[model samples]
Target: MKIVNKLKYIGLAMLTLFVSACEEGFDDINTDPNSPVEVPASTLLTNGIFNVGYTYWDRDLNFEFGELMVQHMAQNEYTEEQRYSFATSDFNFRWGNLYSGQNVAAPTGGLYDLSVARALVEENENLSDAQRANQLAVIDIYMSFGFQTITDLWGDVPYSQAFQPGEYPFPAYDAQADIYTGMISTVTNAVNSIDTSVDGFTSGDILFSGDMAAWEAFGNALLIRMGMRVGNSAAVAAGFGGTLPTSDIMLTFDANQDVANPFYQDKVISSRDDFRISAELVAAMNAQSDPRLAMYAMPAPGSTEIVGMPYGLGDGAAFTLKNSTSDIHTNIEDDPTAPAYLFSMAELEFFRAEAIVSGYITGNDATAFAAAIDHSVAQWGASSPGYGASIAYGSSNAEKLNAIALQKWIALYTNGVEAFAEWRRLDHPALTPSANMAPGVTGIPVRMLYPNTEDGTNGDNLAAVGTVDLGTPVGWDN
Candidate 1:
């Protein structure tokens, strides 16, 4: 009876082994097709491009900080920033957006995505010579733009060893000057890498849709802008160590739901009453009889005057607006489908004018200035009856500079961050400091404080940069 029981157990064990072997085959047959092993380069590019301009610049820098610092707009209720009271910061998020910040589902990571996108094309064994060159060139442009935005805002940031995930858990900060120099080289290589004979990343591209000409123009324009930013127009004149762009770099949006103007989305469609034009902006525009005024603000209550609210005036402050203070105009407030209006022919012309003034280029300042005014004025789709007569460029160096700066200020309405940077660079329009300054704060901030993320993880590295305060200028603020 014992021998019979042992034989029966052995037979059962053999049947169990057969079932386990068959289950291994079932896994291979049932592998999920819907799951993706790797993201495509095109999707990465789309996310990176939109997030940089729309997510980081348009929202965080422009909406939260830029508008007030430049004295363009202010808030009534949540006016802590306007009052010069900065808390920790959006810098970590800024870094993430550009390098590895968590973006919305599907499309995310700024420079990180671009870097991976470039690698994707470079590593692909099937792509032809032209395909590789064009794709890499576009990626280079994206990288340069991302880098400039970083150095310009933060002064010193992780770059040399950044973005190397496990390798650089705590990347060292590179000086802004060094970062700018490297960016010049990167942009140059990008321009050279573009193979006009081959196709580009057309389907994946949102800005210009793979047009190499637009890409080239964008890269070169960025180079010029960065060069000028460092007060080195001569370097920009020679193309930041290479060739300058002759063509224009411009970005205009239509009524596309996916890629509409952020301002329209926030203020008009959502109907949020968080922000309004600042007093300084209204006074300055009205002083110049600027044609772009009406397009920016509505007339004050019971008066034709388009007055704006004072900066730093928080809740219960001496102000008069019935829940709304000079809301943005119909063109912007009404059209959720409005444009981001990235750059203008006027802006390029202004750069040229400033380059000449700084002795970087040999063009006539007056001519360049006049041309800049014409382009900028026309960009607003407004008419000034006596532009050449009343608002013409001045004669003296200081006067002409002020004129250039003032006009540039007017031209840079929605583009608040760039406007703020220029204000620090040139001191144009000479904005009056708000009386509602935060306690212990001296004046309006020239550069935002370093993000607190560095304080916890990169504490030692952050210390090397020195103490961050409101009055301390950024590295390039020289």
Candidate 2:
């Protein structure tokens, strides 16, 4: 979206006035009665939406998701031989946080929640008709994308009644199936309604800069990704008649160079603080002689090889570095300014390859699959030495699929959520979990548990949805 020219004046001036007034107390207060209580739409969108998006995209949550999936994919094994413990629950809280009810704190006010989406939607209505429609379209895409991600991880979620705390003190949970269907439809409609002619969106659009075309592409790409979720289910597959054909769905990858890429700027609080390359992920890349390896990870101390540290290890063990190959020494590597990816042309190619392999689309599967790998490598900024020219695509169909998935895993270093989700679907580049890991986690967790708050506050609705253990596999897990 176009940068708001007035943001500096508003943000800085407001902060200055608020601080100055607070020091004066009630007697010196000169609050403008007619001034807007709420911040500008641009500031709100940037802080509420883009900021959160970048944080989530670059951090442990995304990495954990990818690590779990990669372990299940069999590309690597969780090695206690190494002392890397970031991915382990013992060192990082995310493992347990995700499974337990604790992580629910995010939905209450975090970016992943509906509050920002609602704010954008509500504000768009006050704009001119054309602007309103365009903004609404963008909001729909984001809202649907967010909700779909929530349902994917936690089967039953507060959807219809969610974000309306006053109206529904305890919102009912919607089934995963219903949520997916609704998300697809909502995103589709939004993509179709976008007005490409709009000059610019209100500043704060961190993903695409309010470029309607990019948003349109993103919506369609998301639809294709969602459609593949149910690809293995006969009933669901038949429902779509093997192919979910719609003008909105971009079945082929289009490399629009102008497409906005969300990355960390030279700011301390940006994406850099939240993420790191897991030893498990780095090792997988090294094994394949993957070109993206160096870009994604640094050489571990005392070794040139990129080895992965095992998950579920103790923090005390991290410094030992027995089997560890590399460590991210700076936040610059992990932060959003470090090129945190939301979506990319590479991902689009892989999706199409999957579609072709599954018979959902007509194409030369091998060609599409190989192209996917090539695109993914390029997307990862693999121009450095030691990076391989291309990922090896084995002769067999399974091998070809593995190659596609492996490259996807590499491409997903920044976008771990998608990588994790895809690994579950493809189940390739085999990974094995740590033997010392927790019980009932014999393999990777299939889905995350609903936040415990839902059970207490929205007990009846949660009860209706029934409880599924965090270990339960979903539609994507074969």
Candidate 3:
């Protein structure tokens, strides 16, 4: 009887083993919940935010804006004699391409969609107290930087509801004035709130590799830029309610040299064939004896000297043997070696000079202006032999300002939007419309028209903006 009991127990044990084997059929498959959903904040930040910023640099939108602005400022006509096309008549001034109304989405909208700020705000909720604080600080700085760009171009935007499509599907437009004020306040607070105790920095910050110090400097630099933007408007400047600090936000572009510099490498469109330098831009560089000319424009293929034709001239215009083609080219679009600039030491110094001249801060305008020129030239790889000479600063304030504007123009050859904004503010190196410009389109456009897409999707909001003449001066020019 005892033996029979033992045999029955053995049979039961064998059956239990067989059932367990059937349940664990696949040993290699993963079932952990944490492993599948877990993505590092750094990866999210880089792939999402940095990638968008790099896109802007590659598109050459900035350079196109610069050409239009500078040509108008110089009062250079695009007459038929010069074979010029595009912006001959005022009606032809199309700002829509840059803004991407309904036909396409613009960089301004794209930035918000993939902003590290939004991601951090949403995902960091589960982080520890210290981690959460650091993450928020990073978001604050990035958001301010991008929003500032929007306000600088368009006076007003949908900021309150911006990036919150889920919450407010259609946000009312915020006044440009209000947006600027909020930007300053938010950036200042974020810069101050960055926690030094956090263990790891933000991983995908393409501009600043999660470095708190760099982020702080970038924030301050943006502040200085904003301060100068409103410098001409005492009413606007005063409305800041004393929250905007007077301290200058210093920044540098020597990322290759300074580990703290936030600049990073961006992918080039092609080994060759990106952008061509516009005739309008090249002529300006040539006239000023700008040292950065060589770095900006190469001699047309098969020629040693660079020659630029006027804007109004079409393909029919005469081209010297030294000139490449009669067509205008964006530097970044064409040159294989062209570098993309985010912010640079030269731009910072220019802001400082402008700040001093406008009484936003205290310093020698002339000295600061000269330093700005020097830094700009140096950045263009001008120090090498066979390169162009450096710009010389004259003694008087007017001469100094001229030098600053000239160099700034050269530095901005690859940066169209900035060049256009500067031309509106200073009206220097007078540009005229092309004599050959299309009929009825007279002079350079002061501001881009709202994209036509707004007409259909956000008709009410579009109407609220009213019909601003394409020729109407925007922001700083006012």
Give all TM-scores, in the order shown.
Answer: 0.85, 0.70, 0.70
Candidate 2's C-alpha lDDT? 0.49
Q: After superposition, how far is residue 227 of candidate 2 from its true place, in Å?
A: 1.5
lDDT of each residue in 10-125, candidate 1, tens digit only: 21111110000011111111111332227677767765676566654455677667777887887866677778887556566655555553433213445655655665777778
Residue-level lDDT tens digits of model 3 in 85-146: 32323212122222211112111212332232345444555677666666666666665665
Kindly report which residue stretches of model 2 are placed more than 4 angstroms away from their true locations once superposed.
Answer: 1-40, 58-60, 64-128, 232-283, 311-319, 322-324, 329-336, 384-390, 394-397, 475-478
Question: Candidate 1, residue 472: CA error in Å?
Answer: 1.8
Model 3 segments beyond 4 Å from truth?
1-41, 71-109, 114-126, 197-200, 232-280, 315-339, 384-399
Of the pair 1 and 2, which is ahead by lDDT? 1
C-alpha RMSD values across all candidates: 13.4, 10.4, 15.9
RMSD (CA, angstroms), candidate 1: 13.4
Best by TM-score: 1
List, in order, the clash count of every candidate structure: 1, 26, 52
Residue 358 accuracy (lDDT) in model 3:
57
